[model samples]
Target: MALEKFMKIKETLLGVDIGYDSVKIVALRKGNGFHQLRSSNIIAIPPKSLQQKSADLDKIAEAINTARKTARPRISEKLAVSGLPESKVFTKIIQVPQMTDEELKTAVPNEAARHIPLSLDEIYLDWQKLGENSKNSFDVLVVAAPKFLVENYLVLFKKVNLELIAIETKGIAASRSIIKKGEENTIIILDIGAEATGISIFDLGSIKFSYTIPHGGNTLTKSIAAALKMTNEEAEKLK
Candidate 1:
């Protein structure tokens, strides 16, 4: 998702992260120089509730509402920002010939089709010009997500009475939170979640590359359970 100018200065913002295992909500008050945490809450989802062909949207909506109320934010307008999981997005860094902004707009979609497996009509495409990579070429970060996936999120948030102002990839959010400004060295970030792991490489404060692996905590728990001859619950607790 691209950034939107929906928030005002010093307004309280809600961060909603819906994952495979749980729904998490964080409220933050924006200050002059920093953000203050107001409240945070997490509620677990029923197992396999989100794995079905047709997910239990009512159940998921209930969890989101419960988590939001439990956090107790002072948001009267219910404005929020959500993140798309890395596993559900396609991102790549590509080099393009130096061109003006008007020309780059036409070039990015053509380049996106070459890199992304899906047709251009099926996905929402966004790109940013990183900088000049060479005398004749420049680096462009291309991000794409399926249209249906985004529409589903919009509907889900509507069910919870929240207006999703902006949506971003989790990898970008993690890098912004964890990386220091003006960092000179390259670093890799590993975000391990219940069902997936996000691997992001950052160089000089920008994300250079990112990837997602299907196996995560759940996979580890299963492996541990098999190796130790314990129940999955026991393995989870031990882990």
Candidate 2:
């Protein structure tokens, strides 16, 4: 029955985060009833290839394929979770009356409609119930991303032959790595990427607020290039 039990066990999950200038992949396995990291890899993208409306899809797919091969020994045919770029997603924490999940299910959409600027049909929505407050109200985290943007990511994963199980916002995924279960103290997690910076506040292991700024490492590089009268490439190398 040992072999049977092993066969019944579920496959582990691979987490993927694709940034403007790099792609990161991580695999986790269950050990002693807790999740432990198995392997991780990061692949860099070519310069000037991730511009808006002009991203090099083929290059990204190849990088993902390479990352998969790099971690082949630790990852099998497991499902993967990916995160959309923080610049493209919207996240907010809102208050609602404490109620059952069934009631929240019906109430969330209406509440989201007020917060999200786009039409509901244009975006994919997801939410999580945080906890009850002093007033016996619930704090819910809402996430919305354009449907077309999500579909493009799905297409990219399909091209690489990767099975994507879920897509989350970058801030949420980063919070998972920085916060521990049942942690009481509040803290801020900052992710400075090549093209954007994402800031998130975690309280009691749940994200209470998140914000994304367009300025990042690239901006600093450009400033250095201007100050020294050097090309971007030279400034980047100096940085």
Candidate 3:
């Protein structure tokens, strides 16, 4: 029927997470009822690439190349979703006066300017209305990701031959992968990677709040190395 055809979902979304120490690729087929996972793989980033503030592009490209080979039989849909590190994204939930959609669209930018320390031109801003608050104002989740960092991901995806469609913070993506639809409880999702740790509180399928700590496994390794007077490699094994 036309209704069924209209509601059908067709695109397969491939998620690529390029972490400080590794690259991960996940492919899923989306349908009207549920999404099915097709493939997933992770590969390590080349040495010294993680030491810099901006990643080394040549090393990143090499990691992606290794990931593609490990994940195998290239994904059918080239369009992909990528995540920014927590350090690169700023998220806040604020209350604003409830108004018409058109009115709120105008007010959101003004409100975002107040909360986000960066200039509007320096970041990509997005907001989601989270219904009304107790005081009759609207509760909105605002997200701001730095433009230069976003551009770096776009360039990386281009080198890997993937069309980038969506860029979300890693906390949101972690909660989405683990949380089920229509869930009524609140849960904290923790993603501990090589160089950073992201903690997100998800309530009823929405992210209530998120925080990223600077420490990760690498930090522990360094601490252990110093305490035990061992090399980094030996401390890693102790972990």
Candidate 2 ranges with C-alpha deviation above 4 Å: 1-12, 27-40, 44-59, 70-78, 134-136
Q: Which stretches in model 3 have alpha-carbon errors above 4 Å?
A: 1-8, 29-34, 46-55, 72-77
On the 0 to 100 scale, the lDDT of residue 171 in model 3 is 85
Ranking by lDDT: 1, 2, 3
TM-score to true structure, per model:
0.91, 0.81, 0.84
Please write out the lDDT profile of model 1 over residues 1-239, one tens digit for every residue: 33433444537778888887798888877777566787888999976444344667789889987776666553343778888878888989999999999999999999889889899998999888999899999999999998877777887888888888888889998787788889999989998988899999999987899999998999999999999999999999999
Count of clashing residue pairs in every prediction: 0, 0, 0
Model-by-model lDDT, in order?
0.83, 0.79, 0.78
Whole-structure CA lDDT of model 1: 0.83
Model 3 CA lDDT for position 111: 88
For candidate 3, lDDT tens digit of each residue in 139-218?
Answer: 88989988878777877788878878777888876776588879899899888877778888988788888788988889
Error of 1 at 88 (Å): 1.1
lDDT of 2: 0.79
lDDT of 2 by residue, 140-177 (tens): 88998988778777777888878786678777776766
Model 1 weakest lDDT span, ten residues long: 1-10
Q: TM-score of predicted model 3? A: 0.84
